[model samples]
Each structure stands twice: as structure tokens, then as C-alpha cells.
Target: MWSRIRRAGRVTALVLPCSLLALAASQSAQAALGSAPLTPPSDASVSSRVVQPASGTTQSVMRSESSAASSTSSTSASYTVRETTFGNGTVVREYLTTSGAVFGISWHGPQMPDLNDLLGSYFPQYVAGVKAVRAARGNARGPVSVDDSGLVVRSGGHMGAFSGVAWLPSELPAGVSGSDIQ
Candidate 1:
């Protein structure tokens, strides 16, 4: 009887840690829109990462201009984009303001990243927006668009290829616009 008890205790010891780790992993590990993170989490293997620092006080976010981004301007109202390409071929980009607040997120690839993880606190808003769309149109058959409560999410794609973007209008940094999220 003592041996059985000891065996059960050992099993519990092994299972408890594994279960805790799984729970932690299952939790939302992303810090997005309206918030900042110490180091954003990524479940999938990262193939590459690129950090685009803020340029000077430009009229707009000129992502196409590498030289502009390379320049330093303390007065720049521009932003930074930390792009991560995962092993699955999906690329997720987080747009952060000078204060480190994540104002926007965009993703594109053969498979869609988990939006719940990406949106974090804003997932409920996205769900409500989807419900509203369904109620108005009878069906949100294709493309997901949520334009309410200062949150604008535009996402749509077919099988094997998907892309989407979400941003907080109020959180957008100076001189940034919808076009900058991409």
C-alpha cells in the first residue's frame, strides 16, 4: 500500500508540472493594441526577425523608403515595425509607437495565425463586430471587417493564402494612417 501511494505521488509530481506548462502555453501570450509587452511571445519557430525603427517626423510612414527609416530623428512621429517570419511561412508584424504601445498588427501567409492570441484584449471586440456584421448581412461569408469603437480590423483571404490587419485609430501615432499598418 505504501508503494502504491509513493507511485501515485511520483505520477502527480510529473503530471503537475507538465499540466502547468501546458496551461501557461495555452494562455494568451501576446501583448497587442493599446498595450506593450516585455518580449512578445511566438509559439511557432521563428525563421527571421526584422526591426524597422522610427524615422524622423515624416508626413507619413514610408515603409518603402529604407534610407528614411535608417535616418535618426528625435522629433519623428513615425513608428517601428517588428516583423517576425515563422516557420509556417506566416509573417506577423507589430507596429509600435515611440512609447512601445502596440497600435497595429498585420499578418500574411499560407496559414492564419491565431487571432485570439494576436488580438489579446481586443478579441471580444472583434467577436462583437463579427456578430454585428452577421446580423446586418445575414452572413459574414468572406472577409472579416470590424469598424467600430475606434477599432478597425480588415481581414480576408482564401484557403492556402490569408492576410489581415487590425489597428486602433486612437492609438495610432502622429502622422500614421491606415496605410501604415501594412
Candidate 2:
């Protein structure tokens, strides 16, 4: 009777492992079917320049431009530094740029959870969509133009909001156009 009990225990342990493995496999399969793949990072560098407001100036931000275009003719590259209000009511100074062809996006905002977390989640998708647009359009001889048409949300809070920027030399694919959103 004791040997019979021992044999039963060994069999149960083996079965438990196999059951767990099957469960894990099913969960992974469900994830693959239920969601899209995560976006990858863009291949552009970001730089920051700071300016101080005059002692009694009510102006919130100062603007400066330095024309340094990337070597790629297919890419439109530009940088802007602005003071903007974030979703959590925190005001932040940020610098962002995009390499036209590659659609590289990077920003620095307040250290708060709302600002940082929103950018972290939304940026990847934004870059991915931009890259897709670029790839579909093919090559252009000049920088792509982006127009700030106001903010639209993609996920959480106002942080996911994005302005519609036009890409110039609209080399949109055979069936695509600049008005279409990816």
C-alpha cells in the first residue's frame, strides 16, 4: 500500500509539470492572436538647448533655430523646444525632433508619473506609424514637412494627444494619400 501511494505521488508530480507547460503555451498563443506586436525605437538622436526668460518677462518660452539637416535626403530633420502643459497639470520644457524618413521621436518632460508614463507608452506607436508612412511613400529629395494641427489622443490622458503634421513631397503609395492616417 505504501509503494502504491509513492508511485501515485511521482505520477502526479510529472503530470503537474506537463499541465503547467501546456497552460503557458496556450497563454502565449492567446497573446499572439489578441494583440499587435510592439513598435521598435527610431534611429535618430535628440539634443536640448535651454534659454532663460528676461527678469520681468511674462513669456513662457523662447524659441531658437539651428539648421543642421541629417545626411539622408529622404529624411526631414528638425528640432523644436517648447514649454507646454502636460496632462497632470505640470508644465514642462521639452525638445523633440523627427528624422523625416525614419520618424524618430524623443521628448523630455516633467519627472511626474503622468507625463513620463504617457510618453513612454505612446511614443513607440507614434514612431511606428510614422515609419510606416515613410516606407510607403518611398524616397523624397527634400525634408518632410510636419504641420501641427492640434492634439488627438491615442491612449491615456492628454499625453497621448498628437498634432497632425504634414509630410511634404508626399510620396504616398499607389493607393495611399497624405490625408490618410496609418
Candidate 3:
């Protein structure tokens, strides 16, 4: 029995890393933060028609009582957002400057969007900051925040519902405030 357990452990150790690698590689093409927005991932049903200005709305079929029944977006003179709604009812809004750089990203839904994909080059910094905060706070639960030098992230919610926003302060366009990202 002990030998069987040992063999199972070895198999798990070998398979876990390969599974993680596959997951990392299989991520659908997603727009990275701080870069120009790319096309939304293929899994998402994009908005087909443009509604009137400042009220661009799209319908999405949602699960778990969290449908983005009608996704609405607004654009100001200084910046705009490209919003995408995933199959799980998660809505990601990539805020762009006038010059087209993605300065911020926000999400809200029954599931969390992939920050690793959205944060792009900033993912490492975000991870380090989250670790530090956890270490300092002793595994306390509730909202999690990472306020790095230029990156500001705030996320909080219970199971089945989550929301968060992250933004690069230096990249925000003129006349655009952080409040405008959401």
C-alpha cells in the first residue's frame, strides 16, 4: 500500500507541471494591459452593432445569475473602452488612451477574468505584490489590493461574484481619471 501511494505521488508530481504548462500555452489570444488592445478572445461573443454614443450596449447570455444582459460602454473625448463579455458572464473592459494604448482593465462577474493575460508584462509585479500583502496580513480574507509604484489594483468579492480594476497611473490619458476606467 505504501509503495502504491509513493507511485501515485510521483505520477502527480510529473503530471502537474505538464498540466500547468498546457494551461499556460492554451490561453486564447487576449489583449495585454499597457499595450494596444487586441481583438477579444475568440470565446467571447463580441458586440455586433454599435448603439448611440456613450451608450453602446450588447446582449450576452450569462450563467449563474450573472449575465451582462446589456453591456453598456461610454467614450469620452480623451479615452475609450473596448468591452468584452465572456461566456461565464464576466465582462472585461480595456480602457484605452487616445493614442490607443491600453492603460487600464476592469472586470466584474461570477468568475474572475485572467489577470495574468490582462496584466501582460505586469503580471510578475502583481504576483510579487500579492504575495507581500498576504505575508504581511497573515492570510486574511476579503478584498485584495496591490498598489505598486505605477500599477493600482483593487479586487474584492465573495464566491460566485467578483470584481476588480487595475490601471497604470502614468499611462492614463490627459483629462482621464482613474474613476473613468470602470
Candidate 4:
């Protein structure tokens, strides 16, 4: 009986080692075949190759020209909030873009008690709400841009709310009206 027990212990140890070796060998084989081992390029090397200029003098000149152009364009495209009060005690503030885009709109006063509640709410539900409106009108296809400022309701296409105060786009597809939402 003792001899049989000793033989069983030796067999168990040998089998365990063989199983571990097989696993390691299989993993190495997979890596060698390019099936698993892969690595990303180093960040320093990637940036240096992509952004290096032909010459130092040319890089300085390019940077200066870009800065000047950005300053000029930013000044011309600045926007301001334009407020208007309707007879129904509702105050609407429209943020007009100098480049001709109504970037934002805000409403307040007695008509909407929780007017300022959504001032900083980043409600993703608003996106679903707008898409639903668009889908219901059967105009879900074509070019559409959606913007959420996390403080205000902003979109690219016509989003209806108040009378005559449609979210009109400066450039929309032909035959699409400011009233045709969706």
C-alpha cells in the first residue's frame, strides 16, 4: 500500500509541471505568429515624426502668421446676447453670432417658473427629444448638427417653440423650410 501511494504522488507532480509547460509553450507560439503580441508606438517618437518642421526659421514664421490670423478672425466673430420682452411677460435672450448664426436662446419670466433651472443642466434627454420631434415630422435623414452647451439648448436645425421664433439655420438643404422640423 505504501509503495502504491508513493507512485501516485510522483505521477501527480509530473502531470502538473507538464500542464504548466504546455500552456507557456502555446502562448509563446501564438505571440511568435503575430496573433497576440502587439504594442502602440511611443508617444514621444510619434509626435516628433508628425509635427517636426523642415527648418526652425520656417516654423517660427508659420507660428507667427497663424497667431495673427486667429486673433483677427476671433475679433470679427464675437457674439453678444440680445434680449427682447414679449407682451406675455416672457423675456427671450438670443445670442447672435457675428457670422450670422443664432448660437443660443434663453427664455425667462412668469411663463416659465423653472426658466433658470436648466441653466447648467447637461440633459442628454434633450437630444432624444429633438430627434423624436424630427422623426415624427419624417425629416430625420440628411445633414443635421446637434449642440448641447450644458447650460443652454442649442441645435443646428429648426427646433420649434415660440411663434415666429423658429431656430432657423443660415444654410439648410433646398426645399426645407424653417417650419419643417425633424
Candidate 5:
């Protein structure tokens, strides 16, 4: 009985440290999710600017303009797309409408870009909507969408290749539709 008690105590000691480590890691990740700085959206010209720092490249975010294609124009409006590549091979593209509002944003890669940064002030609403939908559907598969009169957000991705888009519906240019965002 004494040998069994010692064996159990050793197992408990190992498990306690592992559990504490996992808890700390999760807390840090949650904090990091909302720690990215916010960038003001632009309306007129097409210019590529670093809106979100690519993962693992936080120090040189403003200087990492080489990953993006320059802004382009069309008959109705202009857009700037900034592509930031992460260490894990994810590429995030933020699309701004001519009015300077972020009409659309997309991500494709091994990990999803932080929505708290991409969604800006609207992240809370998106989170609430998602919670409601999940509660209602109880395990809904496929894409998640939050549609409001002023804002719209859609996100869906699996494992290593996740992707999502969010847009300000009212800020979309005259000739631009949500489908035109991607």
C-alpha cells in the first residue's frame, strides 16, 4: 500500500505541472489575441499599408510592405490590398473600399489571423453573433455569418487552411458587391 501511494503521488506531481503549463499557455494566447494595434481604414486612394502584423514579425510590421501588391483602381472605386504572410505560411489580405472603410478582409493559411484586429471595433458584435448562432445551431457546420444592416461578417476554415471575410456593408462602393470582395 505504501508503494502504491508513492506511485500515485509521483503521478500527481507530474500531472499538476503539466496542467498548470497548459492553463498558462491558453491564457497567454487569449491575451495575445486582442493585443494587436488597430489601424485606421482609408477611403480614397489605393495604398498598401500594414494593417496587421504578420505572426512572428511584430517588430517590423510597418516596414514589411514588400508582401503586398500595390493598390489598383477601376471605374467606380479604388482599393488597397495589403498581404501579410505569417511564419506558418498564412496570408491575410485586407481590402478597403474607396470610402476608406474596410469593406472586406480575407485570410488563407495555416492559422487564422486575429479577428479582433481585423474586425476592429466590430469584434465584440461578431463574437456575440457567433455565440448566438452556435447556441442556436448546437453544432452547425460550414461557414459562419453575421449579417447586420450596417455590417456583415463571414468566416469559415478548417484546420491548416482556414479563411474568413468581414465587411462594412454600408461602406461598400456603389458598384461593389460582397462577392466582389474576395
Candidate 6:
């Protein structure tokens, strides 16, 4: 019996690394964070990437109006947002700049949106920051915030209610403010 347990431990040790490596490889194959288009090409892709058990329930588009800080002139292209709702009534909103960069993303629903897919390449940095915060706070509960140089992410909620917002500070349009993310 002891020998069987030892063999099982060895197998697990070998399998764990391989599984982690495969997961990392698969994630790296996904599109990059700042470069990829904010929304997926179709609802199918959104369901697979953003939320699980998503029904592709609702999709809506609206123009956001933003005035330049230096002048009253406004541009419609800079403030466009696409909102997609999952089966569980969770909504994921993607905010884009005039140049087509996805500067901000927000989500609210019963379950948390997959950060790996949402943040893309920046997810690693965000994860590292979260670990640091958790260690420092000794696993305190509340909203989680990461204010890295270029990235700002805040997410918190209890069961049946989760919401999060993430944005690239430097990527925001000149007239846009972080508070504008919503």
C-alpha cells in the first residue's frame, strides 16, 4: 500500500507539469490583449472564450460621445462600445478608441468573466499583482485592484454578483478618463 501511494505521487508530480505546460501553450495561442479586436468575430467565439454556458443571448451596440479636452470638438468613432450578454445575464462590454484599440473592458454577472481571455497578454501581469496583493493582505476579502503603470484592473463581487473593469491607462484617448470606463 505504501509503495502504491509512492507511485501515485510520482505520477502526479510528472503529470502536473505537463498539464501546466499544455495550458500555457494553449493560452499563448490566443490573441494578444492590446492587439486583438475587442470583440470576437461571432457569438460562438465569444461564448467559448469569454463565458461558459453562454447562450449568446443578447448583443447590442451604442455610440459613446467624448469631447476632446482641448476643444469642444467630439468624435463618435472614439467612443464605440459593443455589449454582449451571456446566458446567465452577464454582460461584457468592450470599449474601443478611435484607432480601434480596445482600451477598456467591463463585465457584470453571476460569474466572473474569464480573465485569461479578457485580458489576453496582460493577464500574466495582472495575475502577478493579484498574488502580491493577496499575500500582503493575508487573503482579505473585498474588491481586487491592480494599478500597474499602464494597466488598471478592479474586480470584486460575492456569489451571484460579480463585476469587473479593466483598462489600459496609457491607451485611453486624450479626452477620455479612467472613470469613463464604467
Best by lDDT: 3
The TM-scores of all predictions, comma-separated, are: 0.65, 0.19, 0.67, 0.25, 0.58, 0.63
For candidate 4, write residues 1-182 as lDDT tens digits: 01222464463332336665554333211111001111111210100000111221211122232232232223323332333444434445443333323334444444431212222222344556568657877966533334333222333323333221223244322333333321
Instruction: Compose the digit string of candidate 1's lDDT tens values, residues 45-69.
Output: 3221223334433333333223333
Among these predicted structures, which one has the highest TM-score?
Answer: 3
Root mean square deviation (Cα) for candidate 3: 8.0
Q: Lowest summed-lDDT stretch of 10 residues in model 5?
A: 28-37
- Sorting all predicted structures by lDDT, with the top scorer first, yields 3, 1, 6, 5, 4, 2
Q: Candidate 3 on 1-182: residue-level lDDT in tens?
A: 01222464463332335665565345443678888664554567543222232444432323221222222222433455567777567788777665567788888988776788888999898988888888899977668899987898988887889999999999876656677767
The per-residue C-alpha lDDT of model 3 at residue 166 equals 92
**Residue range 1-182, candidate 5, lDDT tens digits:** 01222464463332335665554333211111112222322211212542221231211123222222222222233454444555445566566543334567766777666677677677888988888778789867677988877667788978887887777777665555677555
- Candidate 1 stretches with Cα past 4 Å from truth are 1-29, 37-77
Q: What is the lDDT of residue 86 in candidate 3?
A: 76
| TM-score computed on alpha carbons, candidate 4 | 0.25
lDDT of 4 at 29: 10
Judging by TM-score, tell me the better candidate of 2 and 5: 5
Better of 4 and 5 by lDDT: 5
In candidate 5, position 144 carries an lDDT of 90
Candidate 6 global lDDT: 0.61
Clashing pairs in 4: 134-182
| Superior candidate under lDDT, 2 versus 3 | 3
* Better candidate number, 2 or 6, judged by TM-score: 6
lDDT by residue (tens digit), candidate 6, 1-182 = 01222464463332335665554334322323465443332221232122111332322323222221111122433454545565445677666554445678888987676788889989999999898888899977688999999889999999989998889988876666778676
Candidate 4 error regions (>4 Å):
1-77, 112-127, 130-182
Q: Which ten residues in a row have the lowest lDDT in candidate 1?
A: 44-53
For all predictions, the C-alpha RMSD in Å is 9.9, 19.1, 8.0, 24.7, 10.6, 10.6
Candidate 5 stretches with Cα past 4 Å from truth are: 1-77, 139-142
Q: Give residue 163's lDDT in candidate 5 (0 to 100).
A: 81
